[model samples]
Target chain A: MIAIHGFSPSGNCHKLRMLLEPLGQPYDWVEVDSPNGATRTPEFLALNPNGKVPVLQLQDGRTLTESNAILYYLAQGTPFLAEDRWARAQTLSWMNFEQYSHEPYVAVARFIAGWTPLDSPRRAELPRLRERSHQALAVMERHLQSNDWFSAGAYGIADIALFAYTDVAEHGGVALAPYPALRAWLARVRATPGFVPLPEPDALAADRIAQTA
Target chain B: MIAIHGFSPSGNCHKLRMLLEPLGQPYDWVEVDSPNGATRTPEFLALNPNGKVPVLQLQDGRTLTESNAILYYLAQGTPFLAEDRWARAQTLSWMNFEQYSHEPYVAVARFIAGWTPLDSPRRAELPRLRERSHQALAVMERHLQSNDWFSAGAYGIADIALFAYTDVAEHGGVALAPYPALRAWLARVRATPGFVPLPEPDALAADRIAQTA
Candidate 1:
């Protein structure tokens, strides 16, 4: 069995769970409290020198970091990944967009709103973050207008990658009302077989998220 | 020949040139002046709705966005990408790190210094960007200390991805002097067969980079 070192509320970490459950691939979940400086410790640094989470560790102790890469690794030889070269490249393109263009704005905004104190100075960034989040959302909306899935030709890892954060975007005050196509696509994703939603934020994060919104 | 819509001086765009040259693949370069708002034009948006450069257009009119994904596509079935699954995944992991952790700070700092006016308020971000840039460099240095290349078991697209911004980091006032291993790795990458350095910034931007540095 593979072990995943993750934070429950992080959409990046949740991405792995979303894929693993659907594939019925049993794995161990070793929770890491990323918000409270646990990832900064020496022990965690040994696992990943970059100090982020959702690391996939195999039985022999080899580990893989970066959620999207792990998704690609696990999805290979399964229908979760495509054999067509172009389709695979397109799948990767959307995953790259998720990490670079989408996650930095969408997921970071959620992190600030739900993980920080209400009066934290970082709150100053919300307006700009939300604005950027909408730009990313609009790009997804445009794509969704023509295409039903980001992972080329089907709902696969790319859909799982984008769905993790986009579903919880409202927690960051990024509204779904503006993108009808994106919302419709999200509903379609949820209706897929073996689908599982990300867990709701714990009480403290929920309170902060509510206050921030 | 395929067409590449790119900006010459951009590391993201340069990654493609680096790989294509090594593979002896012929290509058409359609220069997009991204800094001067060329990417914002309606004509360019039809090519890539996300409005970014370094888009790869197949002969049939299918287009691919995201620099790393394009690299993966162009490198397929070639020695530039690994054949083994684990090696390919690790190669992708490093490429993901370059985009998510490295490029936003290192490349953006270079953009701000070389492209923005010396008196532009964006200069205020330089210190923070450079600080984050060094943190990213440190991670690369640590990796290079243990291994010779970022791409698993070879000098491949992952190296091409990281090399683009890192080679010009000093333009952004992110000093390379602190990390000898990283500097050595840059030298090693340049020594690879058919390596092509990114074009120098044009005169106006060059002057700004000098002044900012």
Candidate 2:
């Protein structure tokens, strides 16, 4: 079984759950909650020195950090993965764009708006973050206008990598109304087979309580 | 021929050229100096909506952007590329690390320090950039301390992604003294088979002028 460590609240951490449910892959889900600082623990750091969430521990006992890397490992050679040369390149390109453009603004702003207290000192940066977040959405809206998908003529990890933040962008004060194409894309991804969403904190707590019992 | 649209001084652009020369691959190189506003032109923007450099155009006229993606496509199935699944995943992990952790700091700082004038507004961000650059180097130093190579037992595009900025890091005011292991890793990368250094701007210009005449 693969062990995934992350808070369910994170769009990045939830991406794997979304992918794995559709693929019918069985694995252990370990909740490394940010509120309690589980991921920063020494044990977790040993598994991933970077001390980030969504570290996948393969059955062989090797752990891989970096959310996108884990996604690639899970999707490679599967039908969900792109096959053609340039198409695969396209998948990577969007993933790159996600890290640089989308994740920085949308993801960070969401963290500021949703996860962190609004009155927290970090909220002071929200104005800059919000502006960048809108620009990111604009980029996505433009590319998605012409194509139904990010790459390979179908849905793939590129969509997954970008989708998590793009969908939840509203929590960060990004109004997606101007991006009709991106809005449509979000609906399509939500409709994808085996798509599991991040469980609300209460639902996750119930699951944990059940497991312990 | 594979046509690389790039700026001479851009480390990301140079990554492709460095990889191509080692494998003895022939490619047409087009200069795009975005700092002077060349990349803002519609013709270039059409090739890459993002207007980023290091767009690789194939013989069939398909343009692939993102320097890392281009590297993977051009080096596929070559010894410079990894053969197995795990090695490929590791290669990508480091590449992703480059984008998220290293590039934003090390590469961006290089642009400001080496290219922007002292009074240029971009230069003002250098203090913050330097802090992040050291943080990034610290991350690399720890990784290189245990492993001679980043991914797999041998070197791959992961090295190329990092080596591009890391080798020229001194230009950005990042001293190599704190990272003896990284310096050793740099030596290992340079000593690898088919390694090539960036073309001097004046030397490459002279060659271009000669070819045009």
Candidate 3:
């Protein structure tokens, strides 16, 4: 069985757990709490020098980092990935957008709100992060207005990639009220069989998020 | 023939050109000056709602965004993408690292140096960007010390994706002198068959970069 080293509240880590459940692939989950600096330790660094979750470890002990890459690895032969060449590329484009444009702002804002203290200096970054996060959401909204899914006309890894962050965006103070289409798409993703919701933040983290809010 | 809408000096766009040259594939290059607000125009947005480059338009009029995705699209079934599944996923892990960890700092630093005026407030970001850029470089250096290539144990799209920004990192005030292994890898990429150097920055951009130095 594959073992995933992950932080439960992280959208990046949730991307893998969400997909694996629906794919019916059994895997062990190793909680690596990133906020407490576990990822930076030498022991964890040996698994992934990049030191971010989620890291997928094969039963043979080889490991893979970067949540989206792990999704691609697990989904390629499955229905979660498109078979057509162009469709696969299109799916990859959205995943890249998720990592580059969306996650940086959306996920970081959520991290600041939930993981950092209420008065943390990183809170100063929220306005700009929120602005950029909205821009990314707007792009998704525009696409969703015309199409049903982010991946080659289906709810696949691209949707999974974007969904993980977007669903929890309000934790970052990014409201979904303006994007009806995007909200509908989010519901569609939830309706997928074997879907699993991201774990809620722990009590302390929730307090931070509430105070920041 | 395929048509590539790109900005010549962008590492993202150059990834496609660099690979296409070696692949002996014929394509039309439509230079879209992204630095001048070209990408934000409605027409360009039609091609890529994310309003970024490079956008690959197939002869059939299908478009693909994200430089790495375009590379994956063009490289599939070629030696550029690995045939083995695990190797292919490893390649993607590196590419994801480039976008998520490396390019956001290295490429953005370069943009601030070359595209923005020297006195622009964005220049304030340089010190931190360079610190993170070096951190990314250090990881690459560690990997290159033991391995010769980034993709499937060979020179391919992962190299191309990383090479785009790394080769121009000095423009971002990121000195390459410390990492001998990374420098050697850069040299090897340059020596690859059909390698094409990134085009020179325009006079105004060159001047901005020089002033920052």
Candidate 4:
């Protein structure tokens, strides 16, 4: 069995659940409170020097960090990943885009809104983050207008990767109403077999999100 | 032959050159001046809706975007990518770290320094960017202490991905003197077969980089 150290509400961490449940791959989940500085501890740093979450720990204790890479690894030879080299590469392209272009704006906005205090200086970043979040969503909307899935030929890890954060983008004050195609695609992803939705934010986070959003 | 649309001075664009030259892959380089708004044009957006560079266009006209994804696609079945699944996953983990953790700070700092005017307000971000760049470098230095390469067990695309910006981090005012091991690894990568150095910035950019660095 593999163990995943993740924060329950993080879309990056939730991406694993999105894939594993569909594949029926059994794994243990160890929750880490990232917003509270759990990821910055020395023990967590040993597992991933970069000090980020959603680390996949094998039974043998070898670990892999980065959510999309873990998804790629666990999805190998399964329906969740494509065997075609081009499709796999295209899938990776979307995953890379998620991490670089999409996640930073969309996920960080959600984090600032939900996890940070209302009076925190980080709140100043929300406007720019929201603007960039819309830009990323526009790109996704353009793609979803022409294609049903980001995972090349099917609903695979790429869809799961993009879906994780996009589903909760509204939590960040990034409205989904402007992107009808993206909204439709989100509905389609939710209907996939063995789908597991990301957990709701905790009370404090929920309260903060309600206020900030 | 495949066509690679890239700007000459970008580390993200340079990553493809780092891989293709070593693989002896035949690719036509169509230099796209990304900084001066080439990527924003409707014509280039047709090639990559994301409005970024280093897009790999197959002879059939299908295009793939994202620098690391292009490296992964071009290096398939070659020594540039590992054969073992775990090794490939680890390689991807590092590439993800490059785009998510490293590039946003190191590469952006370089861009703001060299491309923007000296009085540009973006210069205010340099101190924070430099700090984050060193933090990333420290993680790499720690890894390099016990490992010779980031591409799992050998020098591969992961190395190329990280090497691109890391080799030129000083251009962003992020000093490399503290990361001796990382500097050594950069030398080892430079000594690899068919290595092509990143091109020099033009006169105006060079002058800006000199002042900022």
Q: How many pairs of residues collide in each model?
A: 0, 1, 0, 0
Going through the candidates in order, their DockQ values are 0.91, 0.57, 0.93, 0.93
lDDT of 3 by residue, A156-208 (tens): 99999999999999998999999999999999999999999998888988888
Candidate 4 docking classification: high
* Candidate whose DockQ is highest: 3
Model 3 spans > 4 angstroms off: none
TM for every model, in the order presented, reads 0.99, 0.91, 0.98, 0.99
Angstrom error of the Cα, residue B36, model 3: value is 0.7
A148, model 3: CA deviation in Å?
1.2
lDDT score at residue B75, model 2, on the 0-100 scale: 75
What is the per-residue lDDT of model 2 for residues B108-202, given as tens digits with 9 covering 90 to 100? 87676655555567766778787888988887888888888875667878888999999977767777899999999999998987778865445
Worst 10 residues of 1 chain B by lDDT: B204-213
List ranges where model 2 is wrong by over 4 Å: A200-213, B199-213
Tens digit of per-residue lDDT, candidate 4, span A57-163: 99999999999999999999998899998998899999999999999999999999998889999999999999999999999999988899999879999999999
- Supply the DockQ value of model 3: 0.93
Rank list by DockQ: 3, 4, 1, 2
Q: How far off is residue B61 in model 3, in Å?
A: 1.3
The predictions' CA RMSDs to the true structure, in order, are: 0.8, 6.4, 0.9, 0.8
